[model samples]
Target chain A: MLEPVMFTGGVYKHDLVMELVEDLGGYVLQKNVTQSEVILLLLVPKEDMEALKAIISDLRGELVRAPLAGTEVAVVTPTLAIHHLPHTACDIAEYLRRNGAKSNMIGLARGVGRETAQINEYESMLIDEHDAVVFIFGNFVECIRKKEFLYRNINIPVVVTGGPEIPKEELPYAFEYVPSVGRITHRAKKATELGTLDKIIESVGRALDRTRTDISKDPLTTSPPRVMDAVREQVPEVEYSFSPLPIALNLNGVRIKLPYDKHKDAVRAVKFDEGVTLGEVATIRPSKMKDYILVRILPMSETGFVF
Target chain B: MDPMEVFKVEIAGEEFGAKKYREIIMDILQDLGLIRSIGRLYVYVDVKKPVFAVYGLLRTGIPPLLVRDVADVAQAQGGFQIKVNDEEHMSDLLKVLWAKYGRERVEQPSRDVVVVATDTSPSDLPVADLEAEFRQDLTDALLRIAPEGFRNRRNEMTDKSFFFIAAEDTLKSELISEVKEKIRSMENA
Candidate 1:
C-alpha cells in the first residue's frame, strides 16, 4: 500500500525528501514552493513510512496523511454570483485544498433557482472529469431535492451539500448528501461552521475512496503517478505550461496542463520502462477544463498487462 | 438580543431555511449599515411557490447631512473656514461646495480644511442627503438579501416603511396581494 502524505518544510534540503521517495520506489506527485517554504505531496510505501518520518523529524518538518491528494475534486456552485460565491463555494474549495486535493471551483452558468435551475451539457461534462464533485446548494430543502438533475448524468460520485437534512432515499442519484452547509454572507469562523467544512472534506474523501475501489477492480495498466513521472521525464516541455501545477492527477487519469493539440503527439510518444509507448496504454484527449490534455490510462483488461 | 424591535423570518415547511435566511439578512443589512435604520423587519420565503418578500418599518426622519454636521464651520477672514471632521463625505462636501460656489471660490488648502469664499455661512449647505443615501443602500441590501434567481422584484418604499418582494416567476397582482396579506398577518400576530 502506498500512503499518501504531505510534507511541509523549509526550502533548504527539500530535495532530500524527493530523492528518498524516488529511492523507495515511491512517486513525488507534486512539489509546491511558496517563498522560503516547500510543500511536497508524495505516495510513499506504507511499510517504509518510518524511514521518511525519521528524515522529516530530523529536518523539523511536519508530515500528515493527505487522503485526497493525487485526486482532483470539483467544488461546484449554482452560480458565481454573490448568492453562492466568496462564502460557501470559496470556503469549501479552500478547505478541500487544505486537505491536499487539487480542488477546482466550477460555477454553473444557468444553475440557479428552485424552478429554473439547470446544468447544461457542457457544465456536466466539465464536472464529470473530476474524481469527485461537491455541489453546493442553498437552504431550501425543496430546491435541494429538485436540483438532482444537475448530477443525474454525472458519471463520478456526487456529494450534495445543503442546509437541511433530507433522507438518503430522497436523493437517490447523489452518492452522499451532506447537510447544514448552505448560503451565508460571512467566512466560516464558528465552530459549527468549520465543523461543516470538515464534514465536507470527509465526504469528499469517502467519495474518492469509492472511486478508488471501483478502479481497483479493473485497475489501470499503470498508476497515474507513474504515468505522471514518465510523462514529466519524456515531455520536458510540460514544465513550461503556465498552469501552477503543470499536471493535475485524477482518480483514473492525469490532466496535463499543456494545450492538447500542441502536446498530444509529444505526450503520446512518451516511452516507459516496459518498452511501451503512452499512446498504447492511455487515451489522450482534450480536457473539458481549459485546453489541457487529459490522459486516462487504459485498464489492464484492455492493455492485457500492468507495470 | 435582536438589534431590531421585531425581527421575524418565516419559511413555510423549511425551519432551517428560515433560521439561515435570518442570518443572511442580518449579515447583509449590517454589512451595508442598514441595520440601525430598520426598526421592524419581517421576511417571508415560500420556496414551493419560490417567492421571497421582506417588509420592514424604517426609522423615520433622517435629516440630510449638512456641512456643519461633518465639519466645523468657523468665521474666518475673507471666507468661512470649514474643518472637516468626517473625511468619508469630504468628496461629497467638496462637490456640493464647488457646485454652489464655483471651484475657484472653494479653496482646499489642506486635506481636512476647506475655505469657501462666500459672504453667507456655508454651514447650512447640504453635504449629503442621508435619507436618499440610506434608501439607496437599503435597496442594494434588499437585492443582495433576496436569492439571485429572484429576478422579478417589486419594491414599495414610503417615508417610514418599505415592502420588497422577489420571485423567480413574474410578479402578479394576485401574488402581491397574497404576500401582503401574509406579512400583514405576521404584523398583527
Candidate 2:
C-alpha cells in the first residue's frame, strides 16, 4: 500500500526528502517552492513511512497525511462574478488544495439568478472529468434546490454547499451537503466561519473516498501517477506548456496540458517497462478544458490485464 | 447590537433566507462603509416572484466640504496661499479655485500648497459635495447587495430617503408598486 503525505519545511535540504522518497520507490507528485520554503506531496510505501518520518524529524519538517492526494476536485460556482468569487469559492478551493487535492475553480457562463441559472454541456463535461465536484450555492433553499440541474448530469459525486440545512432527501443527486458556507463578501476568519471551511474539506474528503472505494472494486490497468510519470518522461514537450502543472493527476487518469490535436499521438505512444503502450490501455481524447488532452485508463475487465 | 435604528428583512416562506440575507446585507453595507449613513432599513425578498427591494431612511445633514474645512487660508506675498490639510480633497479644491478664478490665477507651488492670484480669500469655496458622493456609493452598494441575477433595477433617491428594487424579469410599473407596498408593510410591521 502507498501512503499519501505532504512535507513542509525550508528550502534548505528539501532535496534530501525528495531523494529519500525516490529511494523508497515512492513518487513525488508535486513540489512547490515559495521563497525560502518548500512543500512536497508524495506517495510513500507504507512500510517505509517510519524511515521517512525519522529523516523528516531530523530536518525539522512537518508531515501530515493527505487523504485527498492524487485526486482532482472542481470547485464550481454559478459565475466568476464578485457575488460568487474571491471569498467563498476561493476559500473552498484553497482549503481543498491544502488537503493535497489539485482543485480547479470553474465559473459557469450563464449561471446566475434563481430561475435563469444554467449549466451548459461543455461546463458539465469539464466538471465530470474530476474525481469529485463541490457546487457552491447561495443562501436560499429554493435556489439551492432549483440549481440541481447543474450537477444532475455530472457522473462523479457532487458535494453541494450552501447556507441553510436542508434534508438529504431533498437533494437526492448530491453525494453530500455542507452548510454555513454561503456567499460572503469578506474572508473567512471567525471561528464559526473557519469551522465551516473545515467541514467543507471533510465533506470533500468523504466524496473522494467514496470514489476511491468504487475504483478499487474494479481497478484500472495502471495507476494515474505512474501514467503521469511515464507521459512526463516520454512527452517532454508537455513541460513547455504555460500551465503551472503540465500534467494534472486524477484517480484513474491524468490531464496532459497540451493541445489535443497535436499531442494526442505522442501521449498515446508513451510506453511502459512492460512493453505495452499507453494507447492500448487508455483512451486519449480532447479535454473539455481548453485544448488539453485527457487520458482515462481502461479498467482491467476491458484490458484483460493489470499493471 | 445592530448599528441601525431599525433593521428588518422579510422573505416570503423562507425563514432561512430571511436570516441569511440579513447577514449578507450587513456584510455588504459594512464593506462599503455605508452602515452609519442608514438610519433605518427594510429589505423584502420573494424568491417565488424573485424580486429584491430595500428601503432606507438616510441620516440627514452631511455638510459639504469647503476650502476652509480642508485647508488653512493665509495671506501671503503674492496672493492667498492655502496649505491643504487633507490631500484627498485637493483635486476638488483645485477645480473649485480654477472655476472661481481662471487656471492662470491658481498656482500649486508644492504638493500641499495652492496659491490664488486674487486678493479675495477663497476659504469659503465648496471643494466637494460629499452628499452626492455618498449617494453614488449607496446606489452601488444596493446593486451589489441584490442577487447577481437581478438584471432589471430601479433606484429612487430623495433628500432623506431611498428606495431600490431589482429583479430578474423586466421590472414593470406594477411590480415596482407591489415591491414598494411590501416594503412599506414591513416598515409598519
Candidate 3:
C-alpha cells in the first residue's frame, strides 16, 4: 500500500528524498518551496518507510501522515460578496490546506439569498472537477435546507456547513453536514470556533474516504500518479505553462495545465513502460476549469486491464 | 456584557441561529463602531417565513465635527493657518476650506497645515457630519448583519431610532407587521 505522507525540510538535498521515493516505486505528489524550506507531499510504499525515515532524519526533515494529500477539494461560498468571504471561506480553505489538501475557493455568481440561491451549469461543472466540495451556508436552517438544489447534481461528495445543527436526514443530498460554522465578521480564534473548523476537516476527510472506497471497487486501469509521471516526462511544454502545479493530481484523474487543443495529441501519444499509450487507458477531455486538459483513468471494468 | 443598553435576538425554531446571529451582529456593529450609537436593539429572524428584522433605539446628539474640534485655528499674517490635530479628518477639513475659500486661496503646504486666505474664521465651519456618517455606517452594518439571502430590504431611520427589515421575497405590509409583532414579543419577553 502507498502511504500518504508530507515531508518538511530544507531545499538543499531534497532531490535525494525524491530520488529515494522514485527508487522505492513511490510517487512524489507535490513539492512546495517557500524560500529556504521545502515541503513535499508523497505516496511512499508502506514496507519501505524505515528507509525513507532514516534518510529524512539524516537530512533533519520531518515526516507526518497527510491523509488528504493527492486530492483537491473545493471550498464554495454563496458569492464573492463581502458578506461570505475573507472570514469563513478563507479560514476553511486555509484549514484544509494545512491538512495537505489542495483547496480551491469557488464563489458562485448568483449564489446568494434564500429563495433566489442558485448554481449554474458552468459553476456546477467547475466544482465537479475536484475530489470533494464543501458548501458554506448561512445561519438559518430554512436557507440551508432550501439551498439543497445547489449540490443535488454534483457527483462528488458534498460536505455542507452551516450554523444550525440540523439532523443528518434533513440534508439528504449532502454526504455530511457540519454545523456551528456559519457567517462571522471576525476570524475564527476561540477554542469552540477552532473546534468547529476541525469538525469540518474531519467531515471532509470522511467524505474523501467514502469516495476512495467506492473508487477501489472498480480500480482504474492505471493509477493517476503514473499517468502524471508519464505526462511530465513526455510533454516538456507543460513545464513552461506558468502554472505552479503544472499537473494537478486528483483522486481519479489529473488536470494538465496545458491547453487542450495544442497538447491533446502529444499527451495522448505518451507511452508507459508497459508498452501501452496513455490514450488507451484514460479518457482525455477538455476541463471545465481554465481550458486545461483533464485525464480520467479508465476503470479496469471498462478497459479490461490493469498495469 | 452587551455594549448596547439592551440587545436581544430572536429566531424561530433555531436556537443556535439566534445565538450565532447575536455574535455576528455584535461583531459587525463593534467593528464599525456602531455599538455605542445604538441604545437598545431588537433582532427577530423567522427562517421559515424567511424575514429578518432589526429595530433599534439610537443614542442621538452626536455633534457635527467642526474645524475647531479637529484642529487649532489662529489668525496668520495673510489669513488663517489651521493646524490639524487629528489627521483622520484632514480631508474633510480641506474640502470645507476649499469650498469656503476658493481653491486659489487655500493652500496645503504640508500634511498637517492648511492655509486659507479669508477674513472669516474657518473654525466655525463644519468639517464632517458625523451623525450622517454614523447613520450611513449603521445602515451598512444592518445590511451585513442580515443574512446575504435576505435581498429585499427596507430601512426606516430617524434621529432617535432606526428600523430595518430584509426578506427573500417581495416584502409585504403584512410581513412587516408580522416582524414588528415578533420583535415586540421578544422585547416583552
Candidate 4:
C-alpha cells in the first residue's frame, strides 16, 4: 500500500527527499517551490514511510498525512458575482486546500436566482472532472430546496452548504449538507465561523472517502500518481508549461497541463516498468478545463489485470 | 449594539434568513458609513412573494462640505492661496477651484498648496454635497443588501427618507404598494 503525505520545508535538499521516495518505489505527485520554501506531495510506500521520515527530519522538514492529496475537488458557487464569492466560496476552497486537496473554484455563468438558476451541460462536464464537488448555497430553506435541480445531473458526490439547518433527507440529491456557511460579505474570522469551515472540510472528506471506497472495489490498471511520475519523466516538454502543477491528479485519472493537439502523441507513448504503454491502459481525451489532456486509467475489470 | 435608532428585518416564514439579512444590511451600511445617517431602518422580505424592501428615515440637514472646511483660504499677491489640511478631499477641492477659476488660473506649486488667481475667496465654494453622496451610497448599499436574485428594483428618495424595493419578477404598482404596506407594519411592530 502507498501512503499519501505532504512535505513542507526549505527548498534546500528537497531533491534528496524526492530521490529517497523514488528509491523506495514511491512517486512524487507534485513539487511547488515558493521562494525559499517548498511543498512536495508524495505517495510513499507504507512500510518505507520511516525511511522517508528519517530523510525529512534530517532535512528539517515537516511531514503530514494527506489523505485527499491525490484527488482534485471543485468548489462551485452559484455565480462568480460578489454575492457568492471572496468570502463563502473562497473560505471553503482555502479550507479544503489546507486539508491537502487540490481545490478548483468554479463560478457558473448564469447560476443565480432561485427560479432562474441553471447548470449547463458544459458546466456539469467540467465539475464531473473532479472527485467531489461542494455546492455553496444561501440562507433560505425554500431557496436551498429549490436549488436541488442544479446538482441532480452531476455524477460525482455533491456536498451542499448553506446557512439554515435542514435535515439530510431534505437534500436528497446532495451526498451531504453542511450548514452555517451561507453567503457572507466578510472573511471568516470568528471561531464559530471557522468551525463551519471545518465542517465543510469534514463533509468533503466523507464524500471523497465514499469515492475511494467505490474505486477500491475494482482498482485501476495503474495508480494516478505512477502515471503522473511516468509522464513527467518521459514527456519533458510538460515542465515548460506555465502551470504550477503541470499534472493534476484525480481519483481515477490525471490532467496533464500540456496542450492536447500538440502533445497528445507524446503523452500516449509514456511507457511504464510493466512494459505497458499509457495509451493502451488509459483513455486520453481533451479536458473540459482549458486545452489540456485528460487521462482516465481503465479499471481492472476492463483491462483484465492490474500492474 | 445597533447603529440605527430602529433597525428591524422581517422575512416571512424564515426566521434565520431575517437574522442573517439583519447582519448583512448592518455590515454593508456600516462599511459605507451610512449607518449613522439613517435614523430608522425597516427591512421586509417576503420569500414566498420573493420581494425585498427597505424603508429608512434619514437624520436630514447635513451641511454640505465647503472648501473652507477642508482648507485654509487667504488672499495672496495675485489672487488667493489655499493650504489644504484634509488631503482626502484635495482632489475635489482642486476640481472645484478649476471649475471656479479656469484650470489655467489655478496653479498647484506644491502638493497641498493651490493658488487660484481670483478676487473672490473660494472658501464659500461647495467642494462636495454630503447629503447627495450619502443618498447615492445608501442606494448602492441597498442594492447589495437585497438578494442577488432580486433584479428589478425601485428606489424612492425624499429629503428626509428613502424607500427601496427589489423583486425577482417585473415589479408593478400593486407590488410596490403591497411592499410599502408590509414595511409600514414592520415599522409599527
Candidate 5:
C-alpha cells in the first residue's frame, strides 16, 4: 500500500527527502517552494513511512498523513458575488488545500436566487471533472433543502455544507452534509469554525474512499500515476502548458493539459513496458474544462488483462 | 456586549439563523467601520417568505472630510503647500484642488505634497462627502449581509436613518408593508 504524506521544512536539504522517496520507489506528487520553506506531497510505501519520518525528524521537518493527496476537489459556490466569495468559500478552499488536495474554486454564472438558481450544462460538466465536490450553501434550512437541483445531475460524490443541522435523509442526493459553515463575513479563526473545516476534510476523505472502493472492484488496467509517468515522458509539450500542475490526476484517469485536437494522437501513442499503447487501454476525449484532453482507463474486465 | 445600543435580530423559525445573522451583520459593519455610526439596528428575517429587512438609526451626521483633515496645510512662497498625511484620500484632495483652482494653479511637487496657488485657505474645502461615502459602504455591507438569493432589494435612506429590505421574490408594496410591520414589532421588543 502507498501512503500519502506531506513534508514541510526549510529548503536547505529538501532534495534529500525527495531523493529518499525516489529511492524507495515512491512518487513526489507535487513540490512547492515559498521563499525559505518547501512543501512536498508524496506517495511513499507504507512500510517505509517510518524511515521517511526518521529523516524528516532529523531535518526538523513536519510530516502529516494527507488522505486527500493526489486528488482534485472542487469548491463550488452559488455565485462569485461578494455575498458568497472571499470569506466562506475561500476559507473552505484554503482548508482543503492545507489537507493536501488540489482544490479548484468554481463560481456558477446564474447560481443565485431560489427560483433562478441553476447549473448550466457547461458548469455541471466542469464540476464533474473533479474527484469530488463540496457545495457551499447558506443559512436557511428551506433553501438548503430546495437547492438539491444543483447537484442532482453531478456524477461524482458531493459533500454539501450549510448553516443549520438537517437530517441526512432529507438530502438524498448529497453524499454527506456538513453544518455550521454557512454564510459568514469573517475569516475562520474560532475553534468551532476550524473544527467544522476539519469535519469537511473528513467527509471528503470518506467520499474519496468510497470511490476508491468502487474502483477496486473493477480495477483499471493500469494505475493513474503510471500513466501519468508515461504521458509525461512521451508528451514533452505538456510541460509547456501554463497550468501549474500540467497533468491533473483523477482516481480513474488523468487530464492532460494539452489541447485535444492537436495532441490527442501524441497522447494516444504513449507506450508502456508491457508493450501496450494508451489508445488501446483508455478512452481519449475532449475535456469539459478548456478543451483539454481527458483519458479514462478501461477496467480489467474490458481489457481482459492487467499489466 | 453589543456594539449598538439596541441590536435585535429576529428570525421566524430558526433561532440559530438569528444568532448567526447577528454575527454576520456585526462582522460586516465592523469591517466597514460603520458600527459606531449606527445607534440602533433591528433585523427581521422570514425564511418561509425568504425576506430580510434591516432598519438602523444613525448616531449623527458625519461631517465632510476636508483637505486639512487629511494633511498638513502651510503657506508656501507662491501657493499653500499641503503635506498629505493620509495618502488614501490624496486623489480626492487633488481633484478638489484642481476643480477649485484651475489645473495650472495646482502642482504636486513631491509624492505627498500638493501646492495650490491661492490666497484663500483651502483648509475648509470639502475633499469628500463622508455622508455619501458612508451610504455607499452601508449599501455594500447590506448586500453582503443578505443571503445570496435575495436579489430584489429596496433601500430607503434619509438624513438620520436607513431602511433596507431584500427578498428572493419580487419586492412588492404589500411585502414592504409586511416587513415594516415585522421590524416594528422587533424594535418594540
Candidate 6:
C-alpha cells in the first residue's frame, strides 16, 4: 500500500526529501516552491513511512497525511456573479486545495433564480470529470429542494451545502448535505464559521473515500501516479505547458494538460517497461475543460492483465 | 442588539429564509456604512410569488458640507486664501472655486491652500452635497441587499424614506401594492 503525505519545509535540503522518496520507490506527485518555502506531495510506501519520517525530522520539515490528494474535485456555484463569489465559493475552493486536492471552481452560466436556474450538457460533462462535486446553494429550503435537478444527472457523488438544517432524505440525489454555509458577504473568520468550513472539508473527504472504496473493488491496470510519471518522462511537450500541474492525477487516470488534437498521439505512444503502450490500456480523448487531453485507464477485465 | 429602531423580515412560508434574509440585510447595510442612516427597515420577500420589497425610514437632518465646515477662509495678499482643514473635500473645494472664479483666478499653491482672485470671502460656498451622496449610497446598498435573481427592480425615494422592490418576473402595479401592504403590516406589527 502507498500512503499519501504532504511535506512542508524550507527550500534548503528539500531535494534530500525527494531523494529519500525516490530511494524508497515512492513517487513525488507534486513539488511547489514559493520563494524560500517548498511543499511536496508524495506517495510513500506504507512500511517505509517511518524511514521517510526520520529523514523529515532530521531536516526539520512538517509532514501530514493528505487524504484528498491525487483526486480532482469541483466546487460548483449558482453563478460567478459577485453575489456568490469572492466569499463562500472561494473559501471552499481554497480549503479543498489546502487539503491537497486539485479543486476547480465552476460557475453555471444561467444558474440563478428559483425557477429559471439551469445546468447545460457542457457544464454537466465538465463536472463529471471530477471525482466528487460540492454544490453551494442558498438559505431557502424551497430553493434547495428545487435545485435538486441541477445535480441529478451527475454521475459523481454530489455534496450539497446550504444554510438551513434539512434532512438528508430531502435531497435524494445528493450524496451528503452540509448546512450553515449559505450565502455570505464576508470571509469566514469566526470560530463557528471556521468549524463549518471544517465540516465541509470532512464531508468532501468522506465523499472521496466512498469513491475510493468503489474503485478498489476493480482496480485499474496501472495506478494514476505511475501513468503520470511515465507521461511526464516520455511527453516532453507537457513541460512547456503553462499549467502549474501539467499532469493532474485522478483515481482512474491522469489528465494531460496539452492540446488533444496535436498531442493525443504522443500521449498514446507512452510506453511502459512491461512491453505495453498507453493506448492499449487507456482511452485518450479531448477533455471538456479547454483543449486538454483526458485519459481514462481501462480496468483489468478489459485489458486481461494488471501492471 | 439590533441597530435599527424597527427591523422586520417576512418571507411567506419560509421561516429559515426570513431569518437568513434578515442577517443578509444587516450585513450588507453595515458593510456599506448605511446602518445608522436607516431608522427602520421592513423587508418582505415572497419566494413563491417571487418578489422582494424593502421599505426603510431614513434618519432626518444630515446637513450639507459647506466651505466653512471643511476649511478656514481669510483675507490674504491677492484675494481670499482658504486653508483646507479637511483634505477629504479638497477636490470639491477646488472645483467650486474654479466655477465661482474662473480657472485663472483660482490657484492652489499647496495641497491644502486655495487662493481666489475675488475680494469676497469664499467661506460659505457649498463644496459637496453630502446628503445626496448618502442617499445614492443607501440606494446602492438596498439594491445589493436584495437577492441576485430579482432582475426587474423599482426604487422610490422621498426626503425621509425609500421603497425598493425587485422581482424575477415583470413587476406589476398589483404586486407593488400587495408588497407595500405587507411591509406596512410588518411595520405596524
lDDT of 2 by residue, B51-169 (tens): 99999999979999889999999999879999999899898999899899999989998999999998888888889999999998999899888999999988999999999999999
**CA shift of A224, model 2, Å:** 0.7
True contacts kept of each: 0.90, 0.80, 0.85, 0.56, 0.68, 0.51
iRMSD of all candidate structures: 0.8, 1.1, 1.4, 1.0, 1.4, 1.1
Tens digits of per-residue lDDT, candidate 5, A166-274, equal 9999999999999999888888999999999999999999999999999999999998878887998899998799887888888898999999999999999999999
Q: Which segments of model 1 are wrong by more than 4 Å?
A: none
Window of ten residues with lowest summed lDDT in model 4 chain A: A92-101
Please give, for residues B40-109, the per-residue lDDT of candidate 6 as tens digits: 9888888877888999899978888889999998999979989999898998999898888899999988
Span of 10 residues, lowest total lDDT, candidate 2 chain A:
A238-247
lDDT of 3 by residue, B154-181 (tens): 9999889889999989999999987888
User: Could you tell me the lDDT of residue A85 within candidate 6?
Assistant: 87
Q: List, for all models, the DockQ compared with the true complex.
A: 0.86, 0.79, 0.71, 0.73, 0.68, 0.66
DockQ score for candidate 4: 0.73
Candidate 1 achieves a global lDDT of 0.92
Query: Which runs of model 3 end up more than 4 angstroms from their true locations?
Result: none
**TM agreement with the true structure for every prediction:** 0.97, 0.97, 0.95, 0.97, 0.95, 0.96
User: How high is the lDDT of residue A199 in model 6?
Assistant: 92
Better of 4 and 6 by DockQ: 4
Q: Residue B125 of candidate 2: its Cα lDDT?
A: 85
Alpha-carbon DockQ of candidate 6 = 0.66
Candidate 2 accuracy as TM-score: 0.97
Model 1 chain A weakest 10-residue run by lDDT: A110-119
- Which stretches in model 6 have alpha-carbon errors above 4 Å? none
Give a tens-digit lDDT track for model 6, residues A147-166.
89999999999999999999
Candidate 5 docking class: medium
lDDT of 4 by residue, A1-307 (tens): 8888999999999999999999999988888899999998899999999999998999999999987788899999988877887888999898888677899999998788877889999999999999999999998999999989999999999999999999999889999999887878889999999998988888888999899899999999998988998999999998899998899999999999999999999999999999999999999999999999999999999998998
- Backbone N/Cα/C clashes per model: 0, 0, 1, 0, 0, 0
Better of 5 and 6 by DockQ: 5
